[model samples]
Target: MTQTHIGVDISKDMLDIFDPRCGHRRIANTTAGIRRWLCGIGTDSFLVFEATSRCDKHLVAGAAAAKIPFVRINPLHGWHFAQSLNLPKTDRIDARMLARFGAERYPEPTLPADPARSDLAALSQRRDQLKRMETQEKNRLQDTSLAILQRDLRASLKALAVRITRIDALIRDHLRAHPQLAGQAKLLRSIPGIGPVTAVEMLAHLPQLGTVDRRSIASLGGLAPKARESGKFKGKRVLGPGRRHVRRCLYMAALAALRHPHLFGNAAARMRVAGKPGKVIVIAIARKIITIANAVLRDQTPFATA
Candidate 1:
Protein backbone atom coordinates (compact mmCIF):
# COMPACT_ATOMS: atom_id res chain seq x y z
CA MET A 1 0.00 0.00 0.00
CA THR A 2 1.21 3.52 -0.77
CA GLN A 3 2.06 5.74 2.22
CA THR A 4 -0.04 8.80 3.06
CA HIS A 5 1.64 12.14 3.72
CA ILE A 6 -0.40 14.47 5.93
CA GLY A 7 0.68 17.99 6.74
CA VAL A 8 -0.48 19.96 9.75
CA ASP A 9 0.13 23.69 10.25
CA ILE A 10 -0.34 24.34 13.96
CA SER A 11 -1.20 27.67 15.61
CA LYS A 12 -2.28 28.67 19.09
CA ASP A 13 -5.99 28.02 18.47
CA MET A 14 -6.31 25.85 15.36
CA LEU A 15 -4.59 23.34 13.13
CA ASP A 16 -4.67 23.69 9.35
CA ILE A 17 -4.46 20.22 7.84
CA PHE A 18 -3.70 19.16 4.28
CA ASP A 19 -4.39 15.64 3.09
CA PRO A 20 -3.36 14.80 -0.45
CA ARG A 21 -6.59 12.94 -0.89
CA CYS A 22 -8.89 15.59 0.60
CA GLY A 23 -7.06 18.90 0.05
CA HIS A 24 -6.88 21.54 2.82
CA ARG A 25 -9.06 21.78 5.97
CA ARG A 26 -9.07 23.06 9.53
CA ILE A 27 -9.61 21.57 12.99
CA ALA A 28 -9.49 22.61 16.62
CA ASN A 29 -6.06 22.42 18.21
CA THR A 30 -7.47 20.39 21.09
CA THR A 31 -7.14 16.84 22.35
CA ALA A 32 -10.54 15.63 21.17
CA GLY A 33 -10.14 17.19 17.73
CA ILE A 34 -6.68 15.74 17.36
CA ARG A 35 -7.91 12.32 18.44
CA ARG A 36 -10.74 12.40 15.95
CA TRP A 37 -8.42 13.46 13.15
CA LEU A 38 -5.90 10.76 14.01
CA CYS A 39 -8.67 8.17 14.01
CA GLY A 40 -9.52 9.13 10.42
CA ILE A 41 -6.01 8.80 9.04
CA GLY A 42 -4.67 5.54 7.67
CA THR A 43 -2.08 3.48 9.52
CA ASP A 44 0.48 4.30 6.82
CA SER A 45 0.02 8.05 7.21
CA PHE A 46 3.02 10.25 8.14
CA LEU A 47 2.65 13.62 9.86
CA VAL A 48 4.78 16.65 9.05
CA PHE A 49 4.48 19.80 11.09
CA GLU A 50 6.54 22.66 12.47
CA ALA A 51 7.84 22.74 16.06
CA THR A 52 5.63 25.52 17.41
CA SER A 53 6.40 25.52 21.10
CA ARG A 54 3.83 23.55 23.11
CA CYS A 55 1.08 24.26 20.63
CA ASP A 56 1.63 20.94 18.92
CA LYS A 57 1.51 18.90 22.10
CA HIS A 58 -1.92 17.47 21.47
CA LEU A 59 -1.04 16.64 17.88
CA VAL A 60 2.20 14.91 18.88
CA ALA A 61 0.49 12.98 21.65
CA GLY A 62 -2.36 11.97 19.40
CA ALA A 63 -0.10 10.89 16.56
CA ALA A 64 2.20 8.95 18.90
CA ALA A 65 -0.72 7.22 20.53
CA ALA A 66 -1.99 6.18 17.12
CA LYS A 67 1.44 4.77 16.27
CA ILE A 68 1.84 7.25 13.44
CA PRO A 69 5.26 8.42 12.39
CA PHE A 70 5.73 12.22 12.45
CA VAL A 71 8.45 14.78 11.79
CA ARG A 72 8.51 18.06 13.70
CA ILE A 73 10.59 20.43 11.59
CA ASN A 74 11.96 23.84 12.56
CA PRO A 75 9.54 26.57 11.49
CA LEU A 76 12.36 28.52 9.93
CA HIS A 77 13.42 25.47 7.98
CA GLY A 78 9.87 25.00 6.76
CA TRP A 79 9.71 28.62 5.68
CA HIS A 80 12.98 28.36 3.79
CA PHE A 81 11.76 25.21 2.12
CA ALA A 82 8.61 27.01 1.02
CA GLN A 83 10.65 29.95 -0.22
CA SER A 84 12.76 27.58 -2.28
CA LEU A 85 9.64 26.35 -4.01
CA ASN A 86 8.28 29.88 -4.56
CA LEU A 87 5.18 28.88 -2.67
CA PRO A 88 2.87 31.54 -1.25
CA LYS A 89 2.65 31.93 2.52
CA THR A 90 -0.56 31.03 4.30
CA ASP A 91 -1.74 28.37 6.73
CA ARG A 92 -3.27 26.29 3.94
CA ILE A 93 -0.27 26.76 1.68
CA ASP A 94 2.05 25.89 4.52
CA ALA A 95 0.14 22.71 5.15
CA ARG A 96 0.41 21.82 1.47
CA MET A 97 4.09 22.69 1.37
CA LEU A 98 4.76 20.51 4.40
CA ALA A 99 3.02 17.56 2.78
CA ARG A 100 5.16 18.02 -0.30
CA PHE A 101 8.28 18.51 1.81
CA GLY A 102 7.64 15.30 3.69
CA ALA A 103 6.93 13.34 0.52
CA GLU A 104 10.13 14.56 -1.11
CA ARG A 105 12.55 14.64 1.81
CA TYR A 106 11.29 11.69 3.87
CA PRO A 107 12.90 13.13 7.02
CA GLU A 108 13.38 10.78 9.93
CA PRO A 109 10.60 10.48 12.47
CA THR A 110 11.12 12.37 15.71
CA LEU A 111 11.63 10.22 18.80
CA PRO A 112 9.10 10.26 21.58
CA ALA A 113 9.77 12.85 24.28
CA ASP A 114 10.96 11.73 27.72
CA PRO A 115 8.78 13.17 30.48
CA ALA A 116 11.66 13.48 32.93
CA ARG A 117 13.80 15.29 30.39
CA SER A 118 10.89 17.56 29.56
CA ASP A 119 10.45 18.42 33.23
CA LEU A 120 14.17 19.10 33.52
CA ALA A 121 13.95 21.38 30.46
CA ALA A 122 11.24 23.44 32.13
CA LEU A 123 13.32 23.74 35.29
CA SER A 124 16.39 24.63 33.26
CA GLN A 125 14.53 27.46 31.50
CA ARG A 126 13.15 28.72 34.80
CA ARG A 127 16.57 28.72 36.38
CA ASP A 128 18.01 30.61 33.42
CA GLN A 129 15.24 33.21 33.68
CA LEU A 130 15.88 33.71 37.39
CA LYS A 131 19.59 34.13 36.77
CA ARG A 132 18.97 36.74 34.08
CA MET A 133 16.62 38.66 36.37
CA GLU A 134 19.20 38.50 39.15
CA THR A 135 21.81 39.96 36.81
CA GLN A 136 19.54 42.83 35.82
CA GLU A 137 18.69 43.57 39.42
CA LYS A 138 22.34 43.53 40.43
CA ASN A 139 23.13 45.95 37.61
CA ARG A 140 20.31 48.25 38.67
CA LEU A 141 21.48 48.17 42.26
CA GLN A 142 24.93 49.28 41.09
CA ASP A 143 23.54 52.17 39.03
CA THR A 144 21.23 53.59 41.72
CA SER A 145 22.31 55.80 44.64
CA LEU A 146 18.89 56.10 46.28
CA ALA A 147 18.80 53.89 49.38
CA ILE A 148 15.16 52.97 48.82
CA LEU A 149 15.74 51.79 45.21
CA GLN A 150 18.91 49.98 46.20
CA ARG A 151 17.08 48.10 48.92
CA ASP A 152 14.31 47.09 46.49
CA LEU A 153 16.86 45.90 43.96
CA ARG A 154 18.70 43.92 46.63
CA ALA A 155 15.45 42.29 47.71
CA SER A 156 14.67 41.33 44.11
CA LEU A 157 18.10 39.81 43.72
CA LYS A 158 17.67 37.83 46.93
CA ALA A 159 14.30 36.48 45.86
CA LEU A 160 15.66 35.54 42.43
CA ALA A 161 18.62 33.80 44.06
CA VAL A 162 16.25 31.82 46.29
CA ARG A 163 14.16 30.80 43.31
CA ILE A 164 17.27 29.71 41.42
CA THR A 165 18.38 27.63 44.41
CA ARG A 166 14.96 25.96 44.56
CA ILE A 167 15.11 25.20 40.85
CA ASP A 168 18.55 23.65 41.27
CA ALA A 169 17.22 21.49 44.07
CA LEU A 170 14.29 20.46 41.90
CA ILE A 171 16.68 19.50 39.11
CA ARG A 172 18.69 17.36 41.55
CA ASP A 173 15.60 15.65 42.84
CA HIS A 174 14.39 15.05 39.34
CA LEU A 175 17.69 13.52 38.24
CA ARG A 176 17.70 11.25 41.27
CA ALA A 177 14.18 10.09 40.51
CA HIS A 178 15.21 9.11 36.98
CA PRO A 179 18.11 6.69 37.23
CA GLN A 180 18.88 6.78 33.52
CA LEU A 181 19.06 10.57 33.48
CA ALA A 182 21.06 10.60 36.69
CA GLY A 183 23.52 8.09 35.24
CA GLN A 184 23.84 10.20 32.09
CA ALA A 185 24.44 13.28 34.22
CA LYS A 186 27.11 11.45 36.18
CA LEU A 187 28.78 10.37 32.95
CA LEU A 188 28.69 13.93 31.60
CA ARG A 189 30.06 15.35 34.85
CA SER A 190 33.01 12.95 34.69
CA ILE A 191 34.59 15.27 32.13
CA PRO A 192 37.07 17.70 33.73
CA GLY A 193 35.13 20.95 33.24
CA ILE A 194 31.51 19.82 33.22
CA GLY A 195 29.85 20.63 36.55
CA PRO A 196 26.35 20.04 37.94
CA VAL A 197 24.77 23.03 36.15
CA THR A 198 26.35 22.30 32.77
CA ALA A 199 25.57 18.59 33.05
CA VAL A 200 21.89 19.24 33.80
CA GLU A 201 21.67 21.75 30.97
CA MET A 202 23.09 19.21 28.56
CA LEU A 203 20.76 16.48 29.80
CA ALA A 204 17.74 18.74 29.44
CA HIS A 205 18.53 20.68 26.26
CA LEU A 206 20.66 18.32 24.17
CA PRO A 207 19.01 15.00 24.84
CA GLN A 208 20.47 13.55 21.63
CA LEU A 209 24.05 14.22 22.73
CA GLY A 210 25.01 10.57 23.11
CA THR A 211 22.90 9.11 20.36
CA VAL A 212 24.37 11.15 17.48
CA ASP A 213 27.77 11.20 15.84
CA ARG A 214 30.53 13.60 16.92
CA ARG A 215 30.03 15.96 13.97
CA SER A 216 26.28 15.95 14.45
CA ILE A 217 26.56 16.51 18.22
CA ALA A 218 28.88 19.46 17.59
CA SER A 219 26.54 20.90 15.00
CA LEU A 220 23.58 20.46 17.34
CA GLY A 221 25.45 22.34 20.07
CA GLY A 222 26.45 25.13 17.58
CA LEU A 223 30.15 24.29 17.96
CA ALA A 224 30.69 23.04 14.41
CA PRO A 225 32.50 25.55 12.21
CA LYS A 226 31.11 26.21 8.76
CA ALA A 227 33.59 26.66 5.95
CA ARG A 228 33.51 29.50 3.40
CA GLU A 229 35.35 28.82 0.18
CA SER A 230 34.81 29.81 -3.40
CA GLY A 231 37.26 29.06 -6.19
CA LYS A 232 40.84 30.00 -5.17
CA PHE A 233 39.74 32.22 -2.30
CA LYS A 234 38.81 30.80 1.10
CA GLY A 235 36.99 32.83 3.74
CA LYS A 236 37.26 32.31 7.47
CA ARG A 237 35.29 29.39 8.89
CA VAL A 238 32.43 30.58 11.08
CA LEU A 239 30.22 29.01 13.75
CA GLY A 240 26.68 28.49 12.52
CA PRO A 241 23.39 28.83 14.40
CA GLY A 242 22.39 26.00 16.71
CA ARG A 243 21.11 25.44 20.22
CA ARG A 244 22.17 28.75 21.80
CA HIS A 245 21.72 27.68 25.41
CA VAL A 246 23.71 24.46 24.93
CA ARG A 247 26.57 26.33 23.29
CA ARG A 248 26.58 28.88 26.12
CA CYS A 249 26.74 26.09 28.70
CA LEU A 250 29.60 24.39 26.83
CA TYR A 251 31.49 27.70 26.55
CA MET A 252 31.41 28.10 30.36
CA ALA A 253 32.46 24.49 30.78
CA ALA A 254 35.38 25.10 28.43
CA LEU A 255 36.53 28.09 30.49
CA ALA A 256 36.46 25.97 33.63
CA ALA A 257 38.38 23.12 31.93
CA LEU A 258 41.17 25.56 30.94
CA ARG A 259 42.24 25.61 34.60
CA HIS A 260 43.27 21.95 34.34
CA PRO A 261 46.24 20.81 32.25
CA HIS A 262 45.27 17.29 31.23
CA LEU A 263 41.76 17.90 29.96
CA PHE A 264 41.47 20.87 27.56
CA GLY A 265 44.38 22.98 28.82
CA ASN A 266 47.10 21.32 26.74
CA ALA A 267 44.98 21.54 23.61
CA ALA A 268 44.24 25.21 24.23
CA ALA A 269 47.93 25.82 24.85
CA ARG A 270 48.85 24.13 21.59
CA MET A 271 46.25 26.20 19.67
CA ARG A 272 47.51 29.38 21.35
CA VAL A 273 51.09 28.53 20.41
CA ALA A 274 49.90 28.03 16.83
CA GLY A 275 48.66 31.70 16.83
CA LYS A 276 44.94 30.98 17.31
CA PRO A 277 42.93 33.94 18.67
CA GLY A 278 41.57 33.87 22.21
CA LYS A 279 37.90 33.51 21.19
CA VAL A 280 38.87 30.90 18.60
CA ILE A 281 40.81 28.94 21.18
CA VAL A 282 37.94 29.05 23.63
CA ILE A 283 35.43 27.87 20.99
CA ALA A 284 37.76 25.08 19.91
CA ILE A 285 38.10 23.92 23.51
CA ALA A 286 34.36 24.10 23.96
CA ARG A 287 33.91 21.92 20.88
CA LYS A 288 36.35 19.41 22.35
CA ILE A 289 34.46 19.43 25.64
CA ILE A 290 31.14 18.54 24.00
CA THR A 291 32.66 15.82 21.81
CA ILE A 292 34.36 14.21 24.80
CA ALA A 293 31.15 14.45 26.75
CA ASN A 294 29.36 12.77 23.84
CA ALA A 295 31.89 9.94 23.75
CA VAL A 296 31.73 9.23 27.49
CA LEU A 297 27.95 9.25 27.42
CA ARG A 298 27.85 7.03 24.35
CA ASP A 299 30.15 4.52 25.98
CA GLN A 300 28.48 4.89 29.40
CA THR A 301 31.91 5.38 30.97
CA PRO A 302 33.42 8.08 33.12
CA PHE A 303 36.11 10.13 31.39
CA ALA A 304 39.63 9.26 32.44
CA THR A 305 42.39 11.77 31.78
CA ALA A 306 45.09 10.52 29.46
Candidate 2:
Protein backbone atom coordinates (compact mmCIF):
# COMPACT_ATOMS: atom_id res chain seq x y z
CA MET A 1 0.00 0.00 0.00
CA THR A 2 1.19 3.52 -0.85
CA GLN A 3 1.73 5.89 2.07
CA THR A 4 1.19 9.64 1.86
CA HIS A 5 3.76 12.07 3.27
CA ILE A 6 3.22 15.81 3.82
CA GLY A 7 5.91 18.36 4.58
CA VAL A 8 5.11 21.42 6.66
CA ASP A 9 7.13 24.61 6.96
CA ILE A 10 5.92 26.24 10.16
CA SER A 11 6.13 29.92 11.05
CA LYS A 12 4.69 31.75 14.03
CA ASP A 13 1.41 32.42 12.21
CA MET A 14 1.38 30.36 9.04
CA LEU A 15 2.02 26.77 7.97
CA ASP A 16 3.21 26.10 4.44
CA ILE A 17 2.28 22.60 3.34
CA PHE A 18 3.29 20.37 0.46
CA ASP A 19 1.91 17.00 -0.57
CA PRO A 20 2.83 14.94 -3.58
CA ARG A 21 -0.82 14.48 -4.58
CA CYS A 22 -2.24 17.77 -3.27
CA GLY A 23 0.73 19.92 -4.34
CA HIS A 24 1.47 23.01 -2.18
CA ARG A 25 -0.63 25.41 -0.09
CA ARG A 26 -0.56 27.60 2.98
CA ILE A 27 -2.77 27.68 6.07
CA ALA A 28 -2.96 29.53 9.37
CA ASN A 29 -0.96 27.81 12.08
CA THR A 30 -3.89 27.60 14.45
CA THR A 31 -5.78 24.76 16.10
CA ALA A 32 -8.70 25.01 13.72
CA GLY A 33 -6.52 25.49 10.69
CA ILE A 34 -4.33 22.52 11.55
CA ARG A 35 -7.42 20.45 12.21
CA ARG A 36 -8.92 21.27 8.83
CA TRP A 37 -5.62 20.50 7.12
CA LEU A 38 -5.17 17.25 9.00
CA CYS A 39 -8.73 16.26 8.21
CA GLY A 40 -8.09 16.53 4.52
CA ILE A 41 -5.01 14.32 4.69
CA GLY A 42 -6.42 11.47 6.81
CA THR A 43 -4.58 9.36 9.43
CA ASP A 44 -2.52 7.08 7.17
CA SER A 45 -0.25 9.92 6.09
CA PHE A 46 2.95 11.06 7.77
CA LEU A 47 3.47 14.71 8.79
CA VAL A 48 7.04 16.01 8.64
CA PHE A 49 7.99 19.39 10.05
CA GLU A 50 10.87 21.19 11.79
CA ALA A 51 10.90 21.89 15.52
CA THR A 52 10.41 25.65 15.36
CA SER A 53 10.32 26.37 19.08
CA ARG A 54 6.76 27.03 20.33
CA CYS A 55 5.49 27.74 16.82
CA ASP A 56 4.93 24.03 16.26
CA LYS A 57 2.91 23.56 19.46
CA HIS A 58 -0.46 23.75 17.84
CA LEU A 59 0.65 21.57 14.96
CA VAL A 60 2.03 18.92 17.28
CA ALA A 61 -1.12 18.96 19.38
CA GLY A 62 -3.26 18.74 16.28
CA ALA A 63 -1.29 15.89 14.78
CA ALA A 64 -1.11 13.87 18.01
CA ALA A 65 -4.79 14.36 18.73
CA ALA A 66 -5.67 13.39 15.18
CA LYS A 67 -3.61 10.20 15.52
CA ILE A 68 -1.34 11.34 12.72
CA PRO A 69 2.26 10.19 12.79
CA PHE A 70 4.86 12.94 12.65
CA VAL A 71 8.63 13.45 12.74
CA ARG A 72 9.76 16.82 14.15
CA ILE A 73 13.33 17.33 12.94
CA ASN A 74 15.87 19.96 13.85
CA PRO A 75 16.04 22.85 11.36
CA LEU A 76 19.72 22.08 10.74
CA HIS A 77 18.84 18.57 9.66
CA GLY A 78 16.33 19.94 7.18
CA TRP A 79 18.83 22.53 5.94
CA HIS A 80 21.44 19.84 5.37
CA PHE A 81 18.87 17.83 3.44
CA ALA A 82 18.19 20.82 1.21
CA GLN A 83 21.91 21.38 0.66
CA SER A 84 22.36 17.73 -0.29
CA LEU A 85 19.72 18.09 -2.99
CA ASN A 86 21.04 21.51 -4.10
CA LEU A 87 17.57 22.92 -3.50
CA PRO A 88 16.87 26.62 -3.14
CA LYS A 89 15.59 28.05 0.13
CA THR A 90 11.93 28.99 0.25
CA ASP A 91 8.91 28.11 2.38
CA ARG A 92 7.37 26.07 -0.42
CA ILE A 93 10.66 24.40 -1.25
CA ASP A 94 11.21 23.57 2.42
CA ALA A 95 7.81 21.95 2.66
CA ARG A 96 8.40 19.98 -0.49
CA MET A 97 11.86 18.96 0.62
CA LEU A 98 10.52 17.85 3.98
CA ALA A 99 7.98 15.69 2.24
CA ARG A 100 10.66 14.18 0.04
CA PHE A 101 12.93 13.65 3.03
CA GLY A 102 10.15 11.91 4.92
CA ALA A 103 9.24 9.66 2.00
CA GLU A 104 12.81 8.62 1.44
CA ARG A 105 14.17 8.55 5.01
CA TYR A 106 11.18 6.91 6.67
CA PRO A 107 12.11 8.42 10.02
CA GLU A 108 10.21 7.11 13.02
CA PRO A 109 7.31 9.09 14.36
CA THR A 110 8.20 11.22 17.37
CA LEU A 111 6.43 10.60 20.62
CA PRO A 112 3.72 13.07 21.52
CA ALA A 113 4.65 15.89 23.85
CA ASP A 114 3.06 15.52 27.26
CA PRO A 115 1.26 18.57 28.61
CA ALA A 116 2.78 18.08 32.04
CA ARG A 117 6.28 17.87 30.62
CA SER A 118 5.53 20.87 28.41
CA ASP A 119 4.59 22.91 31.46
CA LEU A 120 7.81 21.89 33.18
CA ALA A 121 9.81 22.78 30.06
CA ALA A 122 8.27 26.25 29.95
CA LEU A 123 9.12 26.79 33.59
CA SER A 124 12.67 25.57 33.05
CA GLN A 125 13.16 27.96 30.09
CA ARG A 126 11.91 30.92 32.09
CA ARG A 127 14.26 30.00 34.90
CA ASP A 128 17.17 29.83 32.47
CA GLN A 129 16.31 33.26 31.09
CA LEU A 130 16.17 34.67 34.60
CA LYS A 131 19.57 33.19 35.42
CA ARG A 132 21.10 34.73 32.27
CA MET A 133 19.69 38.11 33.22
CA GLU A 134 21.10 37.69 36.69
CA THR A 135 24.53 36.92 35.23
CA GLN A 136 24.41 39.97 32.98
CA GLU A 137 23.45 42.18 35.90
CA LYS A 138 26.28 40.80 37.98
CA ASN A 139 28.77 41.46 35.18
CA ARG A 140 27.49 45.01 34.74
CA LEU A 141 27.67 45.59 38.46
CA GLN A 142 31.31 44.51 38.48
CA ASP A 143 32.33 46.79 35.56
CA THR A 144 30.42 49.94 36.61
CA SER A 145 31.93 52.38 39.11
CA LEU A 146 29.10 54.92 38.91
CA ALA A 147 27.07 54.83 42.11
CA ILE A 148 23.70 55.37 40.36
CA LEU A 149 24.33 52.63 37.74
CA GLN A 150 25.56 50.27 40.42
CA ARG A 151 22.42 50.83 42.46
CA ASP A 152 20.23 50.04 39.45
CA LEU A 153 22.25 46.91 38.63
CA ARG A 154 22.07 45.75 42.23
CA ALA A 155 18.30 46.31 42.22
CA SER A 156 17.95 44.31 39.03
CA LEU A 157 20.04 41.52 40.47
CA LYS A 158 17.88 41.39 43.61
CA ALA A 159 14.68 41.26 41.61
CA LEU A 160 16.06 38.56 39.33
CA ALA A 161 17.24 36.57 42.32
CA VAL A 162 13.77 36.70 43.86
CA ARG A 163 12.18 35.61 40.61
CA ILE A 164 14.57 32.70 40.31
CA THR A 165 13.72 31.58 43.84
CA ARG A 166 10.01 31.74 43.03
CA ILE A 167 10.56 29.75 39.85
CA ASP A 168 12.49 27.15 41.77
CA ALA A 169 9.60 26.75 44.14
CA LEU A 170 7.22 26.41 41.24
CA ILE A 171 9.40 23.71 39.71
CA ARG A 172 9.45 21.79 42.96
CA ASP A 173 5.67 21.99 43.21
CA HIS A 174 5.33 20.85 39.60
CA LEU A 175 7.47 17.80 40.25
CA ARG A 176 5.40 16.94 43.31
CA ALA A 177 2.27 17.14 41.19
CA HIS A 178 3.70 14.84 38.51
CA PRO A 179 4.72 11.51 40.00
CA GLN A 180 6.58 10.23 36.98
CA LEU A 181 8.59 13.42 36.72
CA ALA A 182 9.23 13.33 40.41
CA GLY A 183 10.40 9.73 40.20
CA GLN A 184 12.74 10.37 37.29
CA ALA A 185 14.14 13.43 39.05
CA LYS A 186 14.70 11.43 42.17
CA LEU A 187 16.66 8.85 40.22
CA LEU A 188 18.69 11.52 38.45
CA ARG A 189 19.51 13.39 41.65
CA SER A 190 20.83 10.21 43.19
CA ILE A 191 23.95 10.59 41.07
CA PRO A 192 26.80 12.49 42.71
CA GLY A 193 26.91 15.22 40.06
CA ILE A 194 23.20 15.80 39.31
CA GLY A 195 21.56 18.37 41.53
CA PRO A 196 17.92 19.43 41.70
CA VAL A 197 18.21 21.95 38.87
CA THR A 198 20.00 19.52 36.59
CA ALA A 199 17.48 16.80 37.34
CA VAL A 200 14.54 19.06 36.50
CA GLU A 201 16.22 20.32 33.35
CA MET A 202 16.85 16.79 32.13
CA LEU A 203 13.28 15.74 32.88
CA ALA A 204 11.91 18.85 31.17
CA HIS A 205 14.10 19.05 28.07
CA LEU A 206 15.60 15.63 27.24
CA PRO A 207 12.62 13.34 27.53
CA GLN A 208 14.33 10.73 25.34
CA LEU A 209 17.28 10.27 27.71
CA GLY A 210 16.11 7.00 29.15
CA THR A 211 14.28 5.83 26.06
CA VAL A 212 17.12 6.00 23.53
CA ASP A 213 20.52 4.35 23.38
CA ARG A 214 23.52 5.81 25.23
CA ARG A 215 25.28 7.11 22.10
CA SER A 216 22.07 8.71 20.86
CA ILE A 217 21.40 10.37 24.21
CA ALA A 218 25.01 11.57 24.32
CA SER A 219 24.67 13.03 20.83
CA LEU A 220 21.42 14.72 21.80
CA GLY A 221 23.09 16.18 24.89
CA GLY A 222 26.01 17.29 22.65
CA LEU A 223 28.52 15.15 24.58
CA ALA A 224 29.43 12.74 21.81
CA PRO A 225 32.91 13.48 20.40
CA LYS A 226 32.97 13.38 16.61
CA ALA A 227 36.09 12.09 14.87
CA ARG A 228 37.67 14.17 12.14
CA GLU A 229 39.71 11.68 10.14
CA SER A 230 40.43 11.16 6.46
CA GLY A 231 42.91 8.43 5.44
CA LYS A 232 46.23 9.07 7.23
CA PHE A 233 45.33 12.57 8.35
CA LYS A 234 43.44 12.05 11.65
CA GLY A 235 42.41 15.31 13.23
CA LYS A 236 41.30 15.66 16.85
CA ARG A 237 37.74 14.58 17.69
CA VAL A 238 35.40 17.46 18.59
CA LEU A 239 31.91 17.72 19.99
CA GLY A 240 29.04 18.24 17.56
CA PRO A 241 26.12 20.61 17.89
CA GLY A 242 23.34 19.68 20.29
CA ARG A 243 21.24 21.18 23.07
CA ARG A 244 23.50 23.92 24.44
CA HIS A 245 21.46 24.33 27.60
CA VAL A 246 21.74 20.62 28.32
CA ARG A 247 25.49 20.79 27.84
CA ARG A 248 25.67 23.73 30.24
CA CYS A 249 23.78 21.83 32.90
CA LEU A 250 26.05 18.82 32.45
CA TYR A 251 29.17 20.99 32.57
CA MET A 252 28.20 22.43 35.92
CA ALA A 253 27.31 18.98 37.14
CA ALA A 254 30.71 17.72 36.01
CA LEU A 255 32.44 20.44 38.05
CA ALA A 256 30.50 19.37 41.11
CA ALA A 257 31.27 15.72 40.37
CA LEU A 258 35.00 16.42 40.68
CA ARG A 259 34.49 17.10 44.38
CA HIS A 260 33.60 13.42 44.83
CA PRO A 261 36.82 11.42 44.92
CA HIS A 262 35.23 8.01 44.64
CA LEU A 263 32.72 8.56 41.84
CA PHE A 264 34.42 11.01 39.42
CA GLY A 265 37.56 12.34 41.08
CA ASN A 266 39.52 9.18 40.40
CA ALA A 267 38.65 9.36 36.72
CA ALA A 268 39.78 13.00 36.57
CA ALA A 269 43.00 12.08 38.37
CA ARG A 270 43.70 9.36 35.82
CA MET A 271 43.15 11.83 32.92
CA ARG A 272 45.45 14.34 34.63
CA VAL A 273 48.09 11.64 35.04
CA ALA A 274 47.87 11.10 31.26
CA GLY A 275 48.61 14.85 30.79
CA LYS A 276 45.18 15.66 29.39
CA PRO A 277 44.21 19.34 29.20
CA GLY A 278 42.01 20.72 31.99
CA LYS A 279 39.22 21.61 29.56
CA VAL A 280 39.44 18.14 28.03
CA ILE A 281 39.15 16.54 31.46
CA VAL A 282 36.12 18.64 32.33
CA ILE A 283 34.38 17.82 29.06
CA ALA A 284 35.22 14.16 29.46
CA ILE A 285 33.71 14.19 32.95
CA ALA A 286 30.65 16.01 31.60
CA ARG A 287 30.21 13.33 28.95
CA LYS A 288 30.50 10.62 31.57
CA ILE A 289 27.92 12.38 33.76
CA ILE A 290 25.33 12.38 31.00
CA THR A 291 26.00 8.78 30.05
CA ILE A 292 25.62 7.81 33.71
CA ALA A 293 22.38 9.78 33.88
CA ASN A 294 21.19 7.97 30.79
CA ALA A 295 22.02 4.57 32.18
CA VAL A 296 20.39 5.36 35.53
CA LEU A 297 17.15 6.47 33.92
CA ARG A 298 17.19 3.58 31.44
CA ASP A 299 17.60 1.10 34.23
CA GLN A 300 15.11 2.95 36.47
CA THR A 301 17.65 2.85 39.28
CA PRO A 302 19.84 5.21 41.21
CA PHE A 303 23.60 5.52 40.86
CA ALA A 304 25.38 3.22 43.30
CA THR A 305 29.05 3.36 44.26
CA ALA A 306 29.16 -0.12 45.70
In the range 1-306, model 1's lDDT, one tens digit per residue, is: 767889999998999999998898899999999899889888899999999889999998898889999999988889999999999899999999999999998898999788889899999999998888888888889999999998888888888888889988998899889999999999988898899999989999998988999999999999999999999999999998789899999999888999997667788889989999999998998999999999998899999987
TM-score of each: 0.97, 0.97
lDDT of each: 0.91, 0.92
Off by over 4 Å in 2: none
Q: Cα miss at 114, model 2 (Å)?
A: 1.3
TM-score of 1: 0.97
lDDT of 2 by residue, 1-306 (tens): 667889999999999999898799999989999899888887779999998878998999999999989999888989999999999999999999999999999888899988999899999999999999999899999999999999999989999999999999999999999999999999999998899999988888898988888889989999888999999999999999888889999999999999997888999999999999998898999988888999999999999986
- Evaluated against the true structure, the overall lDDT of model 2 is 0.92
Give me the runs in candidate 1 sitting further than 4 Å from their true place.
Answer: none
TM-score of model 2 vs. true structure:
0.97
How many clashes (backbone N, Cα, C below 3 Å) per candidate?
0, 0
